[model samples]
Target: MEQSFPALPGQAALPGLRHRLSTRIVSLSLGALLIVLAMISGTLWLSWQLEGAGAAINDAGSLRMRANRVAIELARAHAGERHQLDAQITGMDATLARLRQGDPARPLFLPDDPGIRAQLERVSHDWNQRIKPSALADLGVATGEAPAYPAALAAFVDQVNRLVSMIEQENATKTTLLRLSQAGLAAMACMGTVAVIYLLYIWIILPVMRLQDGLQRMAAREFSLRLPVETRDEFGMLADGFNRMAGELEGLYQDLEARVAQKTAELARHNRDLAALYDMAALLNMPNDSEALCRGFLERVMQQFNADGGSVRMIDADHGQLHLVVSAGYSAALEEAEHCMRVDACFCGEAASESVVLIEDLSKGAALSAGRPASDARFGCAREGFPGLAVFRIETQRTVLGTFSLHFRQPLTLPASDIRLLETFGQHLGVALDHLHLSETARQLAVVEERNLVAQGLHDSIAQGLNYLNLQVQVLEDAVSRSDMDETRTIVPLLRCGVEESYQDVRELLLNFRSKLAHGELRQAVEDTVARFRRQSATELALAFNDAQGGPPLQPEQQLQVLFILQEALSNVRKHARAGHASVIVRNGRTFSMVVEDDGEGFDPMEPAADDQAHVGLHIMRERAARLSASLRIVAARGTGTRVELILPR
Candidate 1:
């Protein structure tokens, strides 16, 4: 769930910033530097022009003095003064030429003014023509030979003075221009400095300050705050980025509570589903009959689904019928009427064939109002005032056991999650029902086996005793018919003994038949049998029992068989072996073992019995041991006690 930054209207249509901050600052600095350089260059040029003006004025004044000196030297000319006159004239001509050609190396050049140039030319001409000729005319002659030298020299001095004044005036003008240029340079420097500072603040510093303020606000969790995009620079992009981030954060914070609430609801529903599943599994594991298990399952399921009524119906496959095993929130008459239904009957039967069936608004009026073809076919649920019904198949992976129907008081539609949960519950019910069927089958098999054993016991003991009584009576009848009193008396005693023995056998059989392993407690049954045996024989009997910890306990059938074997062994010891002492030892360990021992004049266990009746108990004991999948051994020798030992399988 990534969202792009929202842009302002028409923002995308704008062009990028052409003159970035860096480019503008660099341009401003370079312009300021160029202005300063130009100002300094102008001032230096003015100073150079003014420099030569002062030297030109000094040269003009010297021309006036040199002219006067030449005139004096002429007036005083003698043969020795002739050389002095010539030298003065030559020095003046040199000065004139030097001024005319200006010395650039010495920075002595005339100003670029028309008036100053004319003055300099006049000075050079006067010195070279008028002063030089006048002075040279009388240089080699007598003193009187000089021609009006004093007057002419004075006129030439006046001309030189005028030239000096003009040079001074030009120098003054240049000096003024130099001073004004310096002032302008100072002003430009000050202005450039201020401009640079203001530009830097506007371009860099101001934006930076605004960005810092925005960050502080953001840090304070003010997500609604946004920075204005003043310029299209990097800082502008930063502002945009910050605004986008704030929008996203605000959006997330706004919906955070809603998302958390949704997650909490989902978690609560999940926990509830888990608890329901655990409770249902526990209910199925209970050791209850099919009817009770189904009844409890229906009641709990109805409560879970918030249904007004519900019923659990099992399929009687052989009869092609659905039998209602349990019902809740239903009228007694309705329960009785709907107790049994054919395979092709109503919603329950249909649900058995399918996985699920949901029927809403089953009322006759609503169905007819909806104009449905099956409107008139409204079933028992509609008549029973349960308009809404949901039927789920109770099924395993391999088979469908039956259907459980939930009846709603009002029209209802279940959500997918609820429907899924109901299906899971149906599978659980299917498994439980299957287990109940298996347990019932096993109980029936145990009953049949016990009945057969009882019949066998009756035929082996009581039946045999009855047959012997019949033979004895026949023999007595023969003796009585012959009028043989001696034979009759002997027969009569035998008959009483035979009848007494038969009665005793019948009682023993009855006792043995009634002996049951209550609650599958083998040890208790053994103790009771041993006590009965001791009382009957008036013999000293000891019973020892030991059960090791963590031993695998015997099943009910195995325990019952073991008890019967012990009973048979004790009976044999009491009736046949005239033993003074007998003991029954029982041990429960990795394998169960029971031994019944007596000290009596014992016979060989390997020898064949004289008749079937004599060894019937032993045969029966061996049969019971075989049924337990255990080992049975009879240890006996002459003049030693007999020991019957039974060891059951692990």
Candidate 2:
């Protein structure tokens, strides 16, 4: 398809005419024309010779007539008409001269053959040497002295007959040559036209077709096409140009394709990284224990990076040790050895100093690359037959929480994106662990608060009851010591009523202390409290739960506070309110609100507690409300029922 234009060493140089296609076509056309013209000229030359031969033949025949006239004129001269005889002899000589020397204007000539010329010369020799002189000498003598004029005339006429035959023979030969030249000219025209057309096709048509095909291929994005440069002409140059352009376009297309592919791969990788980060974040956010969370995270990380072994460790800052929270694909021995390393101890410790440590080829034993101490113990990952390792610090913005590691079975290099993603995973793990710690701390704090409430309740209700019973017993003892039967009956009934009232208070306190919320369902906890309060007391209680504003649920701690506050309010109604009926309404929305109303002989809002029970219960409810960062409003009057409403903001 492709060819070099310049000739190689020792090769024949290309013809200069080859460079100019038009010139070559013109030259070929002209050459064909020249050949046809040459053929035509040859035919015309032969035809002209034949034409002159016809004239020569005609003139030679006339010489016979003229010789006859000269004989007749000689006879007349013998009859004493000598003047006409001279004129006749002059005309005959002139005819012989005209036959000897060819005339181009009349187209009269003989062929330049020795035999024809000799025949003509014989005719003229007899006329001048024998026939003419005899006639002339006889003309000068008597009629009888015209010696053998008739014989001489017969001889001359025979010689002229020989000359005319020789000229006719030469003319016949020219006619044959003329006919052959005409045939050759016709053949030359046909052949030359065919040759010219074939040359034109070879030089022009084929190259143009190839160029057109090349253009079509290029349009189709087939840049690899190369046209053959068969000539050193304009088409050859065009072919060369086409080949160069195709090569350049092919290179450009390949480069563009490569770049596009590279960008596509990079985009896909970026999406994968983002997906992994999202999945890791979602996994960490689930309500799981720290150990389970770490184990799940480590497993996912291992799967993501194709790690052979991995571990998640948490820092025990109090003891300055790292507790191995979770591990996978590691030997038991290695796990045991690395389970409780000191914070300043192994690869994890080193990683704590550097956020991420990627030892691509751990088999190289390049311990110093991560700036580890020379005296430090050998890495557990290396001991586990992992040839490559990556260590990431589990850290937040404020502190280094722990470290996690991935171990590869073969030497592996992580790209920057992978390293950054791993580091992000570590940060997510650290945040999850921190959240778990906060949740545990909050649980502990709630337990302590519950214990304090229990103490306060016992102090306010049970202790007071026990103290009153003791006084009643002392008085009854004194009355009994007096030994009056009526006094004993009165004191015994009073003691019995007092003991029953104290027993009821004790039962209610135990029930309140045992009250617990199930799974932080604030509405369910409130309904349960209201049901319990209604069962325990004579007050008819109706519960209404409304969550029309639909929003996110409260935190565990917040739910607990709401539940406790509701319980305390309900308890206050049962003990101090002396209400006939009560209503509890719980509403959940962007904010949470609970209202506990009682139709009872309500106490004045501005007055002092008047008793320990009312003051302690009211104080505890307010305290619980305050813990939720909510407001508690108590509406009470001497005649109206009491209404306690707690409101918690978003």
Runs with alpha carbons beyond 4 Å of true place in candidate 1: 1-17, 50-103, 125-129, 137-141, 144-198, 205-225, 244-261, 282-292, 325-340, 347-354, 359-387, 443-650
Q: Compute the lDDT of residue 581 as modeled in candidate 2.
A: 84
Query: lDDT tens string, model 1, 274-390?
Result: 899999999999999888899889988999989999988888889988899888888887888888877555442233344664444675344321232222223667677887777
Best by TM-score: 1
RMSD value for candidate 1: 6.6
lDDT of 1: 0.77
Quote the lDDT for 135 in model 2. 77
1-650 per-residue lDDT for model 2 (tens digits): 33335766634344455366777877787887788788788878887888888888887888778777767776666666554767777887887787788899988778889999899888888889988888777766764553666777777778888888887888888788888888887887788778878888898888988889899989999998988878777777678878988988999999999999999999999999999989998999899998899999998999999899888888888999989888888788888888888877644344345567444466776643455532222345666688777777898887889888888888768888888888889888988898998999999998898788888888777777788778878887888888766877877787787788778778877765666555547777777677777677888999988876786678766877777777777777877778888898888888888888988988897887666565887888888887778899999899798999988888
Number of clashing pairs, model 1?
0
Candidate lDDT values, in order: 0.77, 0.79
lDDT (Cα) of model 2: 0.79
lDDT of 2 at 495: 75
Models 1 onward score TM values of 0.72, 0.62
